[model samples]
Target: MRKMLDLLSLKLLRRIEIRYRLINSFLLVSMLPLVIAGIVAYRESSSASQEKVRIFAAELVKQVAQNMLQQIEKIESSSEELAMSERMQNALAGYYSKNPAERAAGHGEIIRLLLENYGSFEYVNQKYVLDRRHRIMDPQVFAQLGDGVARFAEDAPDMKGRPYWDVYSTAAGQNSVVMLRDILFKSNNRVAGTLFVGLRPLHFSRIFESVNLGYGSRMLVIDARDGHVIVSANAADGNAPESGLVVAVARNVAEGRDNFVSYRDGDNKQQLAAFAPVPHTNWMVVNITPLNALNTEVRSIRNKIIAIGVLCFILALVLSFIIARSISLPLKQLVGVMKATRTGNYLIRMDYEGRDEIAVLSQRFNEMASKVHQHNERLEELVAERTRELEQANHQLEALSATDSLTGIANRRRFDEALGGELRRAVRSQKPLALMMLDVDYFKNYNDRYGHLAGDDCLRAIARVLRTSSRRATDLAARYGGEEFAVIVAESDSANAMQLAENIRNAVAALQIAHEDSPFGCVTCSIGVTAVQVDEDMSTDTLLRLADVALYQAKALGRNRVALSDPAGATG
Candidate 1:
């Protein structure tokens, strides 16, 4: 860099006005300290404002959590009232009566009392009561609630008269908060039946209704038992695209404390979050307020600093431009041509008529651009040829993916794709479609006696026969699975299909591959053929199932034979 500056003659450096140079120098020397002072002032102010906002948010969320907890306590108190009621206790005790008529009357009385005192029917789903025996009181209502209720009930005995809280997402797509309380008998103070109440997600909506948090502020009531959010306000919709991020943030925040933290939310906005525990319940309230909403004073200070800096920059920039204008014009033109050349526009040339240093630079640049143009033309042709070769390799890879590695026939994936297309074609053209399933008879025993390698060779020899039998363009032969193959023949009837299967059977028997485990003393396959007149009602699986049934019959009757099944699936 020093060498380059030394090359610039003193006459060239002296061409600019000295006043502009001095002014630019002064701005450079003074601006750094000014910026540092402004930053210090802004940081002090912003820190104070942020602390204020954090404390305010913490208190606000704490109050909200306490209020929500009070509403829940009301439910517990109401349940207590029911537990202390004489009539309700008698009805619950009589629920386990041995007499059928008394049990019926007790069940009716419990229902009537719950409807009048507790608003059990107001639940999105009916509330439940489980007797001391762990049997649900309302047997008919069991179908309404699902296995989740059974699981909740199973835990009731272990709770031992304490309250349990849980949340579940229902089949109806609503979330419910289930609270279980063990009701006690007043006479002996022993435990009676347990009362279960389900609060719908909308019940939490009441807690959120009065909260008028500003935009970008979110609040969630998370069940501490599990990290599931019972209700959320100013929160991301569970079905929204950003729900995963929202859930992650809620779970990522620490629980069981009254604390504040700075975090980034789903929208990529910085947020100040506060957590407050709901008293006496396994839940907490989370408040997330975007930093932008609380950073008004800080933003103003930042803007003032930026404005002062920008003005200083503009003043220095204008003076520097005036001093260098004459030298920069020609250089900027050369830079433009260089940029165009980098983009492969090598034909672009700088137009410089003066005999200055720039003229010499332009001359050399033109020469280099011409040489690059020639080289690039050759590179284009080479790239095209290589691209064609790469395309051919990709095609080969695709074919290999669909072909069976051992038998070199279509794999099951290819067979399924072909069958669907061929079935459509056969139906459209009014042609018969025949499907054949072939399994090597006693193949597992053969593998046990000979070896897996011998079994593989035996199957490969049989694949050759089926592949040869499928001679038409509409025919597809595939290795369905190990020691099993299938063929789809278009434009063929049952008679033709049976003939093909018989030929395939004889060909496998002709292989004369030694199989000492076989009754026939050689490797052979049982073929099952099913041909159907293509109809809209039939599917690829239906045809395959029929052929498989016939193949099973062939294996059952004897080791090496062809069996045919009618469309009705009766084997012959």
Candidate 2:
């Protein structure tokens, strides 16, 4: 009872020691440093992301403002040209003339001038000419002028030759900006009428359409005069919104300040806004990005860092447990096995399943016990068994090295050695030898119709047929290359060689493999047969060349047939 109690106590102490060591090592080597690094990395990444968002938003607003300024400058240039036109001055003066014919002639000349300059600007969608009497000459222009003509006639007359740009609703209820240039009479230098050119708000909205400003962001074009939004684009859905943070930014910009602002909205949500004034116009481009969007990104990174740290902690615990069990259990098993072996039990073994040094030691111990068990029983038999195992291993290695992996026949290297040996034997005996080269008819087309795997199956089937046909002990068959095979038959004349070639062709045809690409309506082979009497002048290479020539002939003669070749020097 005391001995049993001491054994249990020793086992428990070993387990506790292993557990404590693994836990302590994990805490010092992995967990503590990971926690510290995760905190530092999260802080640095959050700051960099916030700075990137600010810089991106500032650049986008500036680009939008610059694009708007260019459009405005184009409109201003077109307006100034029409304001200085001599024909325009004459036409405006004629509108107030006493004679009806003068007004009719002036109307025709003005229409011609407008038609010539119709596509002169890219942004102008429509042009209108209005007189103080609110009369428009062109009926097409009259239909589109809407209430904008009355508004322009009232306000534009005060500007003399200067251009006035204002956003107004058209007759179709679409809002657009109308550039009204005062047409003056050159005789008295007084305003005679106004030229109205309507610009689509879509042109300005499209400027920010392709700019991605993250989630819940918006781009706005505001009238600096009254803090009114002329155009707005919601970055989330690419749609126009009515009111946003642009109103406050525009008011600030109108007070002669162009800058960035951060403030809270009615919902108490933090927002970032930037303002840039369009040059030579009372317009400002404003970009408003929500701060919570950046915070969401930062929070995502923080969660990821925390998740990785937690995952590391869990993995460390699991690995420590696995390592402890792996080491302690195997060592205990080895000790028990050793104790049993010391008591004359040579059949005991350890059931360890791993590839580490411990597993190797356990395997060697089992081997030692197995040897000791068989030591006196059959020493001679053990030597014989080892010799047989070595011989079998050598045979397997030789077969693998010589055989084709795909076709299960002799490979090219083996084929070359066989051919040389056969030629030398045939020369020494002065006996007749025949070489036959076979090829699948249009095998490339077969591979194209089927897949490469099917092609491999076809080659294997062909190899089996060749092996069966050349089954004599003296005959050699081999895979020469892709889709090509060769056979060497000893003690055969031309007649016997032709018979063997015909047998192979018929066997392949009997397989009936589908070949839509071949004229035979199934897979077939072309065989080239050459029989020669061995001599000192003959060589293996020369014999192969003759067989190749015959193979070409067989393919040229509408394939699926055998052809015979003449000797090297004895041509037809």
Candidate 3:
């Protein structure tokens, strides 16, 4: 295994190119920063989202608690008024009187008072008064108290003048809360009867319904004293099961503090819950929401972030390939060219026309190859005088090839090659380069009036003027096409370029070439000038296009005029 690992390492080190290594390094370093930023952002967003959910749930639970307290307060207030009533005290005071008709009238009067004062409340489902002997007053007014109330009375036999709350399920499987209050006889200041107010869980359910706790969330009112659920709304499809989680949360909240928790239930479902105690009662309002339901938005944001990260990684990979190729391809070509030259092939040359140091090296290499080829030719010929004659003839042939046959000036091919070189030089030196495109005004009319030979002579005269105007070795005057000429000036500003263009225009007009059909009466040329402070992003084609645009503007304004292109307006 050790030998195999060594062999794998050797193979990787031997086969990987500098380009691939650079790309791998760039991707590794770039991905770490991106990953770190993504993790930090995700952690911050998740923490913030969790905190917001907790706050919302706690506030909702508090609101529900407030509403329940209000309802309970109304009931307690009504119960207190009835207990303190003079008629209720007088009735209980005369309950054992020998006059049987007086006892019946007192019970009827108490029932009439209950219906008149407390009947309008929607949450008051049942109301009744119990005497000291556990005999319910007006028994026909309410449903049976059932065996639960009898057991409750036996448990609390003292019947202290205080309110007691209990939750119990009826025979119909509906839950209800019963508020039992002790009634006192005012004269003796002792417990005389009990005022019972039974509330259906449906009334509390309506309170929960008023709040929107999202999907698959529930609200419960729990009896803090007994850990019993008094009211559970939207807990399930039909009847909500009294799960262990619900009981645990209720008991935990009954410790007299508002709190929130996240836990999994017996069914392996994640739950989020917040609880608050209802004021003036031994009850707590709990808002329980499923974790998956609340985390939907969070999950979506996570997925979107992951997608963006993947797209960024892909873009980085593409950029790495582009940057690596830009560096490696030139070196590879140089290696090939050097190998060719080693085999006695001196004609091979690098065509890279960039402002980088590599391009400069390639140009020097080509120059060295030319010198070597010339030296070898001189050594083989042995006659120095004949070699000199042949060299001069070669130079003449080279010059003729670059010149336009009719105009005796540089041709379009030579002009294009020189422009590329000059553009590279300008970038390296950080100097300006200017281009001028000129057209002979009404030259076609001249050809129509004179013969093709006369027209050729006319072009030759115009080319001479352009050539004389561009006197510097760095400047080039070329016949771009029929009746159009181009000039390239290096290390010059816009002002200098405009001056040279005007000089060429004036020189052409000074030729005094007659054109009878022309609008100008004499032959003239329109010039378009464009100058640029060269940079890597600017190309030869871009400069040509800008100069051409200026030429069009000059023609549009009038003939034989010079128009300069705005560099800021030029496109890439």
Q: For model 1, what is the C-alpha lDDT against the true structure?
A: 0.74
Residue ranges of candidate 1 with Cα displaced over 4 Å: 1-322, 335-344, 353-368, 371-375, 569-572
Query: What TM-score would you give candidate 3 relative to the actual structure?
Result: 0.42
Against the reference, the lDDT scores of all candidates come to 0.74, 0.76, 0.77
Q: Give per-residue CA lDDT, model 3, range 1-572, as digits (tens).
A: 64654443333322454446565656564555555665677677666766777889899999889988888887788788888988788777666555444676677777887777668867676666777766667644224554445555546544355677666555556655878888887777788888777787777788877787674577887765544567877544334343655666655656754488776765778887788888756677877778777666656766666667667666665545555555566778898999988778898898875555567778999999999999988877877778899899999978877888899999987999999999999989999999999999988778878977899999999998988888899999999978899999999999999999998998899999999988888999999999999799999889999999999999999878999998887765
- Sort by TM-score, top down from the best: 1, 3, 2
Top model number, lDDT: 3
**In candidate 2, what are the lDDT values of residues 1-572, reduced to their tens digit?**
64554343334333444446566656644555556766677677766865776778778888988987787777689767876788877876675676545776777777777777755656667677777665566643434464556755575435544577777766767666777776767777666766777777776778787887785677887776555677776423322332345556655656875477676655677777777777756677877778777666666766676567666566665545545655766798899889887767788888865455567788998898889888845866888999999999999978877888888888887889888898899989989989999999989888888977999999999999998898798898899977889999998999999999999999999999999988898999999999999887778888898899999999999999999998856432
Question: For this target, which candidate reaches the highest TM-score against the unseen true structure?
Answer: 1
lDDT: worst 10-residue window of model 3 = 5-14
- Backbone clashes under 3 angstroms, per model: 0, 0, 0
Looking at model 3, residue 490 earns an lDDT score of 94
Model 1, 30-137: lDDT tens per residue?
567556777787778777867776777688778889888787888778877877788878887687687544676778788777677656346444476777765667
Identify the superior model by TM-score, candidate 1 or candidate 3: 1
